[model samples]
Target: MEAKQLNIGDNVKKFRELKGFTREQMADYLNLSVSAYGNIERNKTDLTVSRIQQIAEILEVDLAQTLNFDASQVFNITHNEVIQGMHSKVENHNHPDEYKEKYIKMMENEIARLKKLAGEA
Candidate 1:
């Protein structure tokens, strides 16, 4: 039952292929260019939790599985109420301009941290 240490990108490709989804189809669904999606599948870009969530949703898999994370650990990290609130705020577009900018910068910094963790920066 052992498997190769495939990264998230590898898992994504495996599931996408298994589910009969074309690369172009996934790219369109994610609103990304074909090349951009290719880079993601190749693990050439920093993978974000949100992006992983989107992929997992698209492929009908668990986000924890998509990230190769333990279910309990992933839930603790990804299911924080504060983080969820931030996402809701961003999505709902209810924040004022200044708050929006501040949140954007904070998110940018977090993405940078994620990139560093992934060794993409």
Candidate 2:
């Protein structure tokens, strides 16, 4: 069986959504136009290593994790499972509920810190 190709843009989009960030927020943070930022998520732009690192920092994930993101590792099987006997296997790497709670708390704290910085500016 051929290995599935990983899409970095899709990975970025998923991570961004998980962190409760809007495209506009990310664009503002990166000082890019919204359309320019959208190009990254849409894979229209060829990303550099530095760009990937910057995105990883914004997503609060390690660069390696961002590159290796597997949706099945995080998403609940029941929610994404296909009906009609087409089995979609999801391997649980971390306890989804616990992991999500911790991640959400971290993101919330980060958001507050950014807001404070924005206010001070």
Residue-pair clashes per candidate: 0, 0
C-alpha lDDT (0 to 100) for residue 94 of candidate 2:
36
Q: Write the per-residue lDDT of candidate 2 for residues 27-75, one digit (tens) a residue.
A: 8767799999999888788888898998877665678766777544443
Query: How does model 2 fare in lDDT?
Result: 0.67
Candidate 1 lDDT, tens digit per residue, 1-121? 9976648886687556444467987787788999999998898989788999988877656886776633232212211121221222111223244434544565587679999999999
Q: Can you tell me which runs of candidate 1 are displaced by over 4 Å? A: 1-6, 69-121
RMSD of each: 16.7, 16.0
Candidate 1's displacement at residue 100, Å, is 47
> What value does the lDDT take at residue 5 in candidate 1?
65
